[model samples]
Target: MSRVFEKRYALSRRALLRSVGGLGALTAMPLLSHEAFAQPVFRVYPFQLGVAAGDPQPDGFVIWTRLAPEPLDLGYGMPSEPVEVKWEVAADAGFRTVARSGTAVARPELGHSVHVEVAGLEPARPYWYRFTAGKERSLYGRARTTPLAGTDLQRVRFGVAGCQHYEQGYFTAYRKLAAEPDLDFVFCYGDYIYEYRGERLANGGTGPIETIRQHNEGEIYSLDDYRRRYAQYKMDADLQAAHAAAAWFTTWDDHEIDNNWVGDIDQDGTPAEVFRLRRQAAAQAYFENMPLRARSFPIGPSVQLYRRASYGRLLDLNLLDTRQYRTDQPCGDEWAATCAGVAAREAQVLGAAQEKWLLDSLSGSRARWKVLAQQIMMMDLDRAPGKAVGYNLDSWAGYAQPRDRLLRQIRDRRIENAIVITGDEHQNFAGELHLTGATPGPRPIASEFVVTSISSGGNGQDQRPDMIEIQRANPQLKFNNAQRGYMICDVTPERWESEFKVLDKVSDREGALSTRTKLAVAADDARVVSA
Candidate 1:
């Protein structure tokens, strides 16, 4: 049996909504001083959005929640003045022994969200937490700190999931993951919420796909719009349960702001200056909703998301921000066989500074496994069926020079057991990473595992039409599954195993999960073999 906490945190999204809807608006209550610490009365339950904790350190982590009785509204029905929120962490799920308690201000400017940075706790242990705003108490949440910097562990496990478009299907993946016991943490690699206002083509294709549900309004632009969008996603019981289950380490991809957006460049050709403002709004909402530390707080349109998380001396997890600093996609961001722009030397994915930082971190780290938790595929995938060799301009294949440079450094530095877990591209993939144009390339330097979407596509097939041909074309590709689910990774000092847990269908709430495939890599080898 997994050595997990006996108590579990569970809640239903609809029940909270139904119960809170009966309460009237906050306007029905009296005004309060901005600086007053006194509890103010809320017309509805202020903790309807649920509670979350993330960014775990050996000694501490950050806990988060928002005062949103009315989640869909632009203002969230929050009062104009700041509200004081109280937080408490306990050794037991029942709160019989409180470990730490503090107060935080949920300012109206930040959509009345509370972020409490907690410390002075034991390392590598489960802690239960909750928040209080006025008379309402939040759902109980569980968080765990990492092992000490140099401590060694026998094993580690985590889930990789993202790209959940609310309109596509249900978030049964999250619900299942929440039930998983003894997970160290969850890594949401990107596309936490799709920015599409309504049903859109499955990648600018011929026809618009039908939606199981729909967004509340048109395309989001303002801060309130982004906040409401996040609220809609957070309101899901499964997503909330997943947040409450354990601490999450999150990083974003294109859809969080706009589809295929690179820095200030919008896919629809929106002016860079105008898009910057939208990005600012998106960034702020992202900061407010996520269980992130102060290091990732948004400043205008910029947020520092690239950081390293260590789990003892066994793994060094590097969370990357690929969308925020990337150059505009090459060849108009389309699939092409032989475009000159695809190999442009100036094109960058991680940019110079971030590239240097990643390289330095990987080289300097002493951990047995160096895991790159990021968005977008780093493998050079040729999508064309036959020998045409088309590549996605939005992926690393478009920026060949930079990708080759990074791979060369990894090979030269001999960074053993390097693995990359990626989101985006609503399909599952397991492949070996090799230099693009090497003459009969040597052994792979690293490995990559791409997890499929939580619910981006409606119901996905077990196999795609061109999957076999594409695999034949690229021998480095080991496996591909077009399904809706996530990856559960089990790591040890000697090897790493990735279990591709997929859903039969995500169109409804009754989809069942099963292991589609399992792949493993040895400590010093990059070859991906069936487990």
Candidate 2:
């Protein structure tokens, strides 16, 4: 069966607010007529999922949204029809006077996603924005630019979250994060969407626990499959609310396609060439659904996912790409010398281009703090100290050479106040990073705070005995908690504090949230102190 016809797909009632009469038909709809346009029934796009602004510079930030009207193809098909989208940024919530306003068009070729890179704005100031298409308008989204160079920012609060498996539970975590009005923005560290065909639980189940759309009848190996999955995930209300609540900076990890997939390797060691078409499809869908700049658009099986963002004089965040340019998975006994060899100098995690970019950016950065916004833990997370190896070899530990080199650069160049915010493992961890083999041997060079997952594995799972033993052996690891929640990081000129907030219960949809732990790093020292 054809991909499109695999399911009797129909746009939801909420998606039909904007008629399918093309731009002309939109005007004819009672809700989109001239009078309606004058007083538009401003409703956010349901499947646009989330609204986010990112890559904030002194001048501007990119605002994004996807149009999901009926006859779904009308919004993403070729010919690239122009759909007028009006956007405004304001100092206040009511939009009494606009700070910035412009007209943009959502082109069909890019899945009708609109990316408005607004400029001519003041730095270190908060702004509220919204978008309108015909009679349909998105919710007000908040974003801000980095402060001016050398300006003292007393505080910067941001939310960190990842691994939101839609079927596991509702995006209640996001709902709570959105309610926190003090947040400047959100940092999503990958696994935003899982590519599994259905929920695979410890107890055998053949379908998703909860889903907006049916899963792919089989494994997703096509662009259409990925696109449809994105659409399904976006239909979640909580995810949409969070996106509307704040601007987001994002990166992707393995589940965006398959677990542990690097470059083009299959579970059976099949070359990426065999799955080239599927990989291309996944990359394209990822680009269409993300609030990424044009430069990161997918060309084929690859997309440039690494870049830098500045937060005024306070911080420079370098988001890394650990998937695309990585070496193959390691081989040998889980904890043997053979496995360690796989992490040799030839092994790579950041790829050549990304490594050079990261090194140069870190060395040249003038911000008070250099933040590495990466997908996995940067600290050494050996499941077993000297004997047992970790279960997964796709993380930084697997690319030991690249990890050491990056840490060496930070130490050699005297990159002060370096910090890494990461996500991926379904656990929260706080650690002080030390460059073991550098000239300044075994000295603390950076700090890393890893956020837990959203709803991948519930919070009630029994603790793993191996992990418990591993923690007892690794003194560098300050804190560890297996839970379902997010992290909140507050940065300032004097200190950066992080709180590991966990949901009271992931088994229940309306769970409460509490702080699992807290860690702080002082600007004068690169060490992590308990808060």
Model 1, global lDDT: 0.84
Q: Evaluated with lDDT, which candidate comes out highest? A: 1
The alpha-carbon deviation from the true structure for residue 246 of candidate 2, after best TM-score superposition, in angstroms, is 1.4
Q: Which stretches of candidate 1 lie over 4 Å from their true place?
A: 1-35, 200-210, 439-442
The CA lDDT of each predicted structure is 0.84, 0.71
For model 2, residues 86-119, the per-residue Cα lDDT tens digits are 7788888899879888655555555667677677
Point out the worst 10-residue segment of candidate 2 by lDDT: 20-29
In terms of lDDT, the poorest run of 10 residues in model 1 is 1-10
TM-score, cand. 1 vs. native: 0.91
- For candidate 2, list the clashing residue pairs, or say none: 146-312, 147-312
Q: What TM-scores do the predictions have?
A: 0.91, 0.84
Model 1 per-residue lDDT tens digits across residues 1-531: 111111122222222121112321111122233323445666677787899988999988988898888888757876555665678899999999999986666767678787777889999999999988767789899999999999988889999999998988899999999999899999999899888776443442456555688898888888888899999999999999999999999999988899899988998898999999999999989988888777677788999999999998899999998988888888788775648877888888898889999999999999999999999888888888566768877888888988899999999998888999998889999999988855335478899999999998767888787887887778888999899999999999999999999999888899999999999998898899998
Please list the residue runs of candidate 2 whose C-alpha ends up more than 4 Å from where it truly belongs after superposition: 1-50, 70-82, 200-217, 332-340, 385-391, 435-442, 460-464
lDDT of 2 at 15: 26
